[model samples]
Target: MSDSTDLPRFPQESSPGPTGPTGPTGPTGAAPTRPGTVNGAFWAFLAATVISIVSGLLVLGERDSLADAVRRSDAKLTAQQIDQAATVAMVAAVVIAVLIALLYLLFAVKLRAGRNWARIVLTVLTALQVLSLLAGSGGSWIGYLSCLAAVIGVVLSFLPESSAYFAAARPVRR
Candidate 1:
């Protein structure tokens, strides 16, 4: 057998040299960067959340009309019952709006983090909103505007740059 000194050694075995640099590395790249489309989507979601809250407030503001309509449809309802029903309806509307706004914010944060699942979920939600807008006729302008904002957010999320960023952010398989 040849002497150990005659054998060629690999670079790693030769020495414990200093590494070039140290930094964080995710499945994606060195660092995450926010694309313009993502920024637009974030703002759109925020606007949609605000619009939903305002719409709920408007519904609350029209409590009298709601109670009158309810009373007209059901003549047997006493004044106290009518008032309770209107208050319950307004409270339910406000709660639902708050929940939806919270969901929008959650999606915005996840999307900003380059989560592909969040993008898909937001897209699906936007589609549902569009369908609801098309099927309903009694929605106020605020509802329509919120739908428009959702559409814009979805559109921006699907832009070419956004797509590329999401692709780059995908988890790398070992």
Candidate 2:
């Protein structure tokens, strides 16, 4: 038998096996590179989240005006009843806005990681926002801005490169 040092050393014994750091496939198999389009979509979705928060705060700022409007619209409501109605509406608005922002953040992160399901969910949400605006929901300019960003994000998610990246990552990704 040969001496220990005379035998093939660790580095010479093997380069990289199937379980190497680069993985079984090859180099770049560890993680698919995120395309520019997917990255852009991520940023757009993040911007939409920020816009939604700001819009929610602005709506909250108009709480007094909302109460006045409700008071004017219904002549039969007592002062306490009007206040309660305004409070309920405000709470509903806050809940809806928070839910929307949370969804955007969750899906945006997954989309950046090349999740096709996230892309689809984000697309559906964008459609809903557009439809809401078109249905005369009395959206403010800020709402329109948020919708525009979401639309851009969804569109980017469907680009050819983005689609390919998502597809490739699905097989190797967990």
Candidate achieving the largest lDDT:
2
Worst ten in a row by lDDT for model 1: 16-25
Candidate 2: pairs in clash: none
Off by over 4 Å in 2: 1-29
Model 1 C-alpha lDDT per residue in residues 1-174, reported as the tens digit of each score: 889999887776443222222223353335445679988987887888888889888887899999999999999999999999999999998899889889988988888887888889989988988888889767788899998998899999899878766765653222
lDDT of 2 by residue, 1-174 (tens): 767888675544533323422234233356666789999999999999999989987877888999999999999999999999998999899888899899899999999997899999999989999999999999999999999999999999998889878766765654
Give TM per candidate.
0.82, 0.81
Clashing pairs in 1: none
Native-referenced Cα lDDT, model 1 = 0.80
lDDT of 2: 0.86
Q: lDDT per prediction?
A: 0.80, 0.86
- Candidate 1, superposed: residue stretches over 4 Å from native: 1-29, 172-174
What root-mean-square deviation over C-alphas does model 1 reach?
5.7
